[model samples]
Target chain A: MIRRIAFNLFAWTIVLAVAFPLFWMVLTSLKPQFELFRRPPTFLPETWTVEHYWTLLSSTKFLTYFKNSVILSTTTTLVVVAIATIGAYSLVRFRYRGRESLAFLVLFTYLLPSVVLIIPLYLMLVQLGLSNSILSLVIAYTTFALPYALWLLRSFMAGIPEDLESAALVDGASRLGAFRDVILPQLLPGIISTALFTFILSWNEYLYALVLVNSDSARPLTTGVMNMLVSSFNIEWSLLMAASVMMSVPLIIVFAFLQSYLTRGFGAGGVKG
Target chain B: MAEVVFKDIVKSFGSFTAVHGLNLTIAEGEFVSLLGPSGCGKTTTLRMLAGLDFPTSGSISIGNRVVNDVAPGERDIAMVFQSYALYPHMTVYDNIAYPLKKRGVRKADRAPMVQKTADLLQLTELLRRKPRQLSGGQQQRVALGRALVRDPKVFLLDEPLSNLDAKLRGYMRVELVELHRRLGRTMVYVTHDQLEAMTMSDRIAVMEGGKLQQFAPPNEVYREPANRFVAGFIGTPAMNLIDGTLANEAGAWRFASPGITLTCPPLTDDAVSGPACLGVRPEDVLLGEGPIRGQVQVVEQTGHENIVVVKIADGIRLTGRAGADHVWRPGETIQCAVDVSKAHVFAAGPSGQRLNRPLTKDQPRLAKEGA
Candidate 1:
């Protein structure tokens, strides 16, 4: 009992240490302007106010950046998942010349650092006249997300028994129909987790979004928050903290909803009958 | 409902031939079992018949239509897998209804069909439960229901009851035979269990080393095995084979082995001589006062009967069954009579072909000699 208590105590300390910054961000976001400049920063706010949120929601371009981020990330997710699922399924069920080479290429590309490809991707998008637009950001993000998503989903697909689809086929359902009615339903958890991972990665992606898109209309939350810091010499710490908290809310909600599937989906393809 | 035929079907994976130029024909509504040990290509042949695997050469026809180029989905056949591959994600109702749904059956039409199948398999109350919720037997029935609901021309089952417990497997065997009698579909069942094939099939196609060793009724396969493998594989406590030679002593035919000799039936051409293997069933040994003598090595009483293992010359063990009332003890001198008329002589080679003897009219002296 004493050891358990000690372990709990140690775990709680680490958890608090990790969670303090997030708590302070939300706490500071609700503080009035004078409290921010206080001599010894108080752990708890003496008085809570919504003025920073009001400024972010009503006066600034935060909502626009939020909307752009949603559009950019959702597009990336849809394109990545659709392409990767087909690529992964093909890599799993079909055998042909170069099948091994193709699978290896996916893993090799996933291991290649995205930083090395960004410059060439930027130049390609510029040549296509798609720079400064959300389309360019969507395309660029999908390129980086595809390889890893394919690798993950391919392993999951390999776990599912081929007999299921073969049984379906011999029952008079077409091959594509078997894939739809049998394989896809079993892949739901893995597909959702893959989508969630790609979405979060695209949503928080700063480098490509910053380099490819410059206009306020297409600027996502990552660049939008960074713009605020550099916009003036006097950075409104309150506003910045509020925007950070606001930006993290969607991701937190998404993770909360998909957390079970994320862990379960990764463990699924290891051993099955 | 329809006959299936495989004309010279050959399936190979790269250089390894799983099945070699197999030709088989199943009559309409005949329950045929492809029985063999593992890797003998019985399942591969069944898969080819189900259109899951394409043969490297030769043609397959279902109801006289060539299906070599057809897709599995278009083959109009259903298969029950060894794993009973019921869709785990779907409920029993949905799983049974899926094949109908795929064929574009209206929703209104699907329910009644599924209900009838569910009732047939006694799965009406469990329709809402998933496959994981069901027991092994229940899952097996669900798989059968899924296959039977389609009313396909042929039903291919690959070790369908192998996963069940021994009691359940025995019960399912009877149920399967009854089901075959009721449905009368051209069913091709594949299994390694000889008992399953013997008790359930109308005819058993015994295979060994990727070749068909014998295709006959179970009793015929037991009584008249075509090769040494079939004879060795078909029976429980298996058929006893002793190496011997056919000898003519003083113008009378006799079978000679070490420390034993018996009068043999005359060959038709009188050409079956030299080395041969003598096969005898355990039940054909009458345990008392006869031409063969041995030392009893062991006695195994299995409820109603005793399996007596007797050691003859040079440590050769011959097993014979005795009634429970006959008490046998180890190290006792036992004398048994060989029912020579019920014995078999197989050529001493890999083939082990059964040698033919002259008819009763030509072998009148043999009966007189026995008397």
Candidate 2:
């Protein structure tokens, strides 16, 4: 019993240590700006206030950035998951020349650093007259997200038994009908996990957003929040924490709703049997 | 019910031939099993019949219609996969109803058909449960139910009961035979288990190395195997094959081997007298009396009988079955007799053909009388 207690205490300590920054962000966001930098630094807020949150909502472009992030992330996730699901299915199931090399090429693209592709992407977007727009950022996000999502989903698709589709075909379903009825339902947990990863990746992405879009109208949460809270003269600690907490709320919601599917997806992808 | 035929079927993947020059015809409502060990092209043959695969060169026909170009769905057939392949997300009702839905059956009419199948398979209560919730036997029944619900022209089962426990496998064997009798649908089953083929099929097609070895009734396959491979493949405590020489001495045919000699049955007109392999089932080698003598090497008891392995000479052993009433010990010298009428003599080699004269209509009793 004592050993069990010690182990539990040790485990919680590591968990809290990992979670401390997040805890501090929520705690500092609630604190009045005066309480943020106290002598010893208060563990709990001495004066809890929502004025920073009110200011973030009412005065700043925080809501605009929030809206932009939602649209950009959702669009990127839907588009990436859609294309990756079909692409991954073809890579895993179909017999064709160069299929294996095509799949390897997808993974090979993922190996290339985002910074290396950003220059070419910027050139391409400018040539298309799409620079400094949300459309350009969406295109930019697809470059990294598509490959990652496709590679992740390929293994998940391979995990599904080919016999299921054969049984469906013999049972009178057409090729697409078999995919819709049998493959899709079985692939739901995988799709959820891939969509979650793509969503979070797009949401937290910084490098592409920094390089692609410059105007306030198309700025996502990453750059918008950084520009709003951090300035040339001073850094607004409480307001930055407030923006961080707000930025994480959507992710937390997504994680909460799909927590079971995410764990199942990861577990299923690891071992075939 | 429909007749199925495969004419000169050949399936090759690149340069590796999985099946070669295969031809078979199944009469309407026949239960034919394609039986062989793994990598023997049994499943490949079944897949070609199911339209999941195309033959390199051949014509496949069902009910007199050439169906080589038809899709699996359009072929009016259903298949039970070895894995059962139940859609993991659907309940039993939906799994069985899916094919009907694809066939564009009215939704209202589907329930009664599914219900009747469920009733036939005794799965009424499991309609709401998912496949994972059921036992292996129940899942097998659901797979059969799915195939049966369609009333297709043919049913193809690929090692459907292999995943079940031994007792469940035995039980499903009888259930499947009865199911076939009731449905009267042409069924093609593929399995490696010789016992399953022997117990369940009307005729067994034994395959090896991508070629059909013998396609005959189970009794004929057991008693009169076509070649050395079939003789060794089809029995428990497989037929004892002794490398020997057969010669025509004046009028009588004689088989001679180290420390053993026996009179041989009459051969067909084309029989060649030379190096031959003698095949005798363990039961046909009667223990405790005759002209041959050997030392018992081992005795395996199985309640009803004992499989006695006797060393007749150096590097030569013959397995013979004895009644369980007698307890025979290793190293004991014993006398035995060969039932030559029931024995098979094949021309020497792996693919050596049976050289026994074909049994005529009145010759079966004559052969037994000679035994």
Give a tens-digit lDDT track for model 1, residues A1-273: 999999999999999999999999999998998999898888789999989999889988999999999999999999999998899899999877899998888778778788998899999999999989999999998888998899889988887888888889987788888999888877877799899999999999999988898899999999987896557567889999999999999999988988886555232321123
TM-score of chain A of each: 0.93, 0.94
TM-score, chain A only, candidate 2, equals 0.94
Which lDDT tens digits does candidate 2 get at residues A8-57?
Answer: 99999999999999998899999998887789889999888988889999
TM-scores vs. true structure, each candidate: 0.90, 0.95
> Candidate 2 on B300-320: residue-level lDDT in tens?
999999999998888878899
Off-target runs (Cα >4 Å) in candidate 2 are A263-273, B248-253, B364-371
What lDDT, from 0 to 1, does candidate 1 have?
A: 0.85
Most accurate candidate by TM-score: 2
Candidate with top DockQ is 2
**What residue runs in model 1 are displaced by over 4 Å at the alpha carbon?**
A230-235, A259-273, B243-276, B286-295, B313-315, B331-333, B336-338, B347-351, B356-371
Per-residue lDDT tens digits for candidate 1, residues B1-110, read: 37889899899987899998898889999999999999999999999988888999999999989999998877888899988888877889998998898888899999
User: Model 1, A108: alpha-carbon shift in Å?
Assistant: 1.4
Q: Please give the TM-score that candidate 2 achieves against the real structure.
A: 0.95
